[model samples]
Target: MRDWLIQLRKERKLTQQQIAEGAHIDRAYYAQIESGTRNPSMAVASQIASFLNINTFLFFPEHLSEPFTTALRNSPIIVAHCDLELRYTWMFNPHPDFNTDVIIGKRDDELDHNEGTIGLMKIKRKVIETKKPIRQYVSFPLSDGLITYDVFAQPIYNDGNQLIGVATVSTELLT
Candidate 1:
């Protein structure tokens, strides 16, 4: 839960104080929530969700999908898709062509072990574990320097609730 909040704040390029102020909550309270020391009440959650213009259930992403995909894609940030192993699934930027060597194919490597894809890989597991989406990814540089990505994802499952894969997005934050 705390991880999700932190990710969401960072993805929005916002800070705890900012969200707390905007959501009309105490900064200390929000910090506790982000630090895993507290949980927001239903009313507080609703207020925060409304202020963020995000669906309230976003706190738990089993509640995310088709209805939110459009909203998520239209976000100023990039959006993407990936298999459970964290391979380079697909992206939505419309700029970085997948056919280019800039990306890879199935069975390329675990995202965490890959040079540019590590951070994304790390967070993907969190999404899978929590069955929720995260917003921010700890950005790290690859050996190539300019090829790094800051990514996050929403885990997708089947009607049977079987873990399918993830829908992701990222940006070359360093560039």
Candidate 2:
């Protein structure tokens, strides 16, 4: 979501400040939306989408299949999916330490800017670029200390067999 917004905004050679101004929103507030800290309301989403010259539906994951959504919801593992741009489109049962509400519409880099995050981002990139599945151990810092998980990521394809995104499941958390 944010990735698409950012990409579209960049394609138009617009800055966050500019878009914010055009949308009649505070730059700081707009930054929050771009950072996935806060979600925009439908009206706000519409406004932003219009300002960016993109469809508002891009902000929603309505295109995802119901069976996939159900699988994610029913999975006990922390399941998530991100577009080819690495922006999260869907997530379920995220880490307890994270705010699930803020996970969607975020890029891997937006979530954190640490070495751990960078490593994870690299792995995600590889999965997308190679169109392969990967299973690895990942550790990231938490407020208390650190947590680790076994992460499995695979590329997602549409009906035409075109890669669209990456799906991941992270479980077996170790503190």
Candidate 3:
């Protein structure tokens, strides 16, 4: 991903500083994001993507017609899918302490036991109810430390445009 961004910037005859300025972010911070050492907030990522003339989802990358779990397992970003009932169905690159066998059929509150999990559940519920997309900067506590993510959640739909569930892709942030 860093290499792709570097190459694209080069093709456009732009420098990291130029992009940072265009996005109105600190150059050093933007450099860290481009190098994958730090993840940007959704607003920052969107600004950068707009400056680069690319879709925001390009940062996460997903394949069509593949199972959500499979597509996310190979993704550069952390991803998860939930059923219509808001029970977790699949996860990729989940928190280190998470056990798939235990969490597969559970809600965040049932397994995570954290206040942040409650907030995340609310966000998921909103997406499911509204059938709209949302991007937020969120942080949660883990066993070892706190982690922040540029969280992107959206309602999933079938071929008939019927709501199926919700899916989320989040890139972890350094700070």
Candidate 4:
């Protein structure tokens, strides 16, 4: 049984039915969650956490560690997460000329207002709207020169299953 979940529900004076309704799920499903007979998806967990006034991360295991960091550090591909507004939220192994400081919280247009950045933004917007993944070759004009990359972008969701933004992996294509 999920003792912690049960304890929290009791403390709030909420029954399984109430939580299920609040989370837009069936009571039996919620009951299964409480009984530990079923595992909740990220979206369901987020809803339950919201009802309990807690962070959704509580439902997930903390597995990100040194290995993850090390791999990302050594990776050649650039990885980034952006908000719905297309502003960068997190990035790893960015281009040689650009650092985290220049990327985070900034949109592509903010970094470089050109045809290339415009095209990139359009691709990201399409992914966000369609809730799908897209892969294309994109070019960016930098101070050094124009660099082309194979970019893959997909919709990113919050724990609530809400589409929050897009995550991207970009690898420079050598001629």
Considering every candidate listed, which one attains the maximal lDDT? 4
All candidates: CA RMSD (Å): 15.8, 7.9, 16.4, 11.1
TM-score of each: 0.40, 0.57, 0.56, 0.60
Query: Candidate 4 at 9: error in angstroms?
Result: 37
- Which of the two candidates, 2 or 3, achieves a greater lDDT against the reference? 3
* Top candidate (TM-score): 4
TM-score of 3: 0.56
| Candidate 3 local lDDT, 1-175, one digit each (tens) | 4666765677568999999999999999988988889878778988887576553444554433367657556454777787777776556667777754455546888777776787788889999888899888777898878887788999987569988678998887776
Model 2 worst lDDT window (10 residues): 50-59
For candidate 4, the lDDT comes to 0.79
Return whichever of 3 and 4 wins on lDDT. Answer: 4
Per-model CA lDDT versus the true structure: 0.60, 0.73, 0.75, 0.79
Deviation (Å) of 38 in candidate 1: 56
Residue 102's lDDT within candidate 3 is 53
Q: Which ranking of candidates, highest TM-score first?
A: 4, 2, 3, 1
Better model by TM-score: candidate 3 vs candidate 4: 4
Worst 10 residues of 1 by lDDT: 96-105
Q: Is candidate 2 or candidate 4 better by lDDT?
A: 4
